[model samples]
Target: MNIAIGCDDAAVELKNTLAKHLESLGYEYTDYSQPAEDESNLYADVAARVAYSVAEHKHERGIIICGTGIGVSIMANKVPGIRAALCHDVFSAIRARKSNGAQIITMGARVIGSELAKTILENWLQADQIDPSSLPKVQRINEIEDSILSKSE
Candidate 1:
């Protein structure tokens, strides 16, 4: 599966480590992250790119990193059809995919170390998606999204 990855300056090192790990696992990924020295690439900018990739079906999943993960998660979820989850632990990461069918996982560089982040990433990657019985609930989420977007126009 093709994965999209991006991060801000604060998370550059962790992002790099994750990218290498993905490579070792034989996963194809697009890197939307900017260098640490590049001040122009903001978290929202990078988050939008990763979120859009999955939303457009160009990628199956994505990983985004920032100072606290919250900013990127909030920005990614703003896009229609994108379920971005901010996970700092293994359980949350598992639920992000297994329960919510999130296509993107966001992590915090300052809040979690590289090893824990790696573990979380691995667990999330291995988790199965939402169960078949949960399809109706997932559909309801989509319906709510459509209803909100429709009334806006």
Candidate 2:
């Protein structure tokens, strides 16, 4: 699967590690992340780019990172069709994909170690989307998003 990844300065190192792991797994990925010294690269900017790419189906999935992961997740979820989930553990990562059908997973570089992050990423990638038991709920989520978006427009 083609994946997209992005991060702020605080998570640049972790992003690099994840990129290398992706390569080892033979998965193609686009790195939307900027260098640590690039002052113009904000967490919200990176998250928005990656989230939009996935939302538009230009990429199959996205991984966004920041100091606390919360800011990026909040920003990414603002996109109309984007389902960005902040996940720090294996189970949450799996559920993010399987139950919520999230196209983007957000992580905190300062919150989790590199090894743990890799495991979580792998779990997310390996997860199956929209388990039968959760299909109605996932559809309901999309309906809710459409309802809210329609009001704004």
Candidate 3:
């Protein structure tokens, strides 16, 4: 499957590493954001581009990165039908796909080590998406999220 990747300055290094991992996994990707992060980099643009690209790509998956992964996740979620999850471990990453149908995964450069991030990505891609009814964790989280979403609208 084709994947879209985006990252700000703080995550450029990690993003590059992920690119290699994606290549090794035989997944094609398009980089919407550049490699440089000096002082002028803003994650909003990168997040929006990645989100929009995923929307446009039709059935493709994506990954986004930022300093804490929160910024990119927040930005990506603002777009319709974009379920972006900020994950630091295998369980969250795997469950993100399994329960939420998350199209994009965001990782924090400062929050997780490369090794852990790699493992999370690997499992997330392969794990069976759990049924919403069978998993209370998934059901409750989505319910809470939906409540918040309803209030926001």
The parts of candidate 3 lying over 4 Å away from their true place are 35-40, 128-153
Q: What's the distance in Å from true for residue 45, model 1?
A: 0.6
Residue range 70-121, candidate 2, lDDT tens digits: 9999999999899999999999999999999999999999999999999999
CA lDDT of each candidate? 0.92, 0.93, 0.83
Worst 10 residues of 1 by lDDT: 32-41
Rank order (by lDDT, best first): 2, 1, 3
Q: What TM-scores do the predictions have? A: 0.93, 0.94, 0.80
Residue-level lDDT of model 1, residues 27-69, one tens digit each, is 8899988643654589998998889888999999999999999
Question: Once superposed on the true structure, which residue ranges of model 1 sit more than 4 Å away at CA?
Answer: 35-39
User: Mind sharing the TM-score for model 2?
Assistant: 0.94
Per-prediction tally of clashes: 0, 0, 2
lDDT of 1: 0.92
Q: Which stretch of 10 consecutive residues in model 3 shows the poorest summed lDDT?
A: 32-41
For model 2, the local distance difference test gives 0.93
- How many backbone clashes are present in model 1? 0
Model with the higher lDDT, candidate 1 or 2:
2
- Residue 135 shift from truth in candidate 3, angstroms: 11
- Order the numbered candidates by TM-score, best leading: 2, 1, 3
Candidate 2 error regions (>4 Å): 35-39
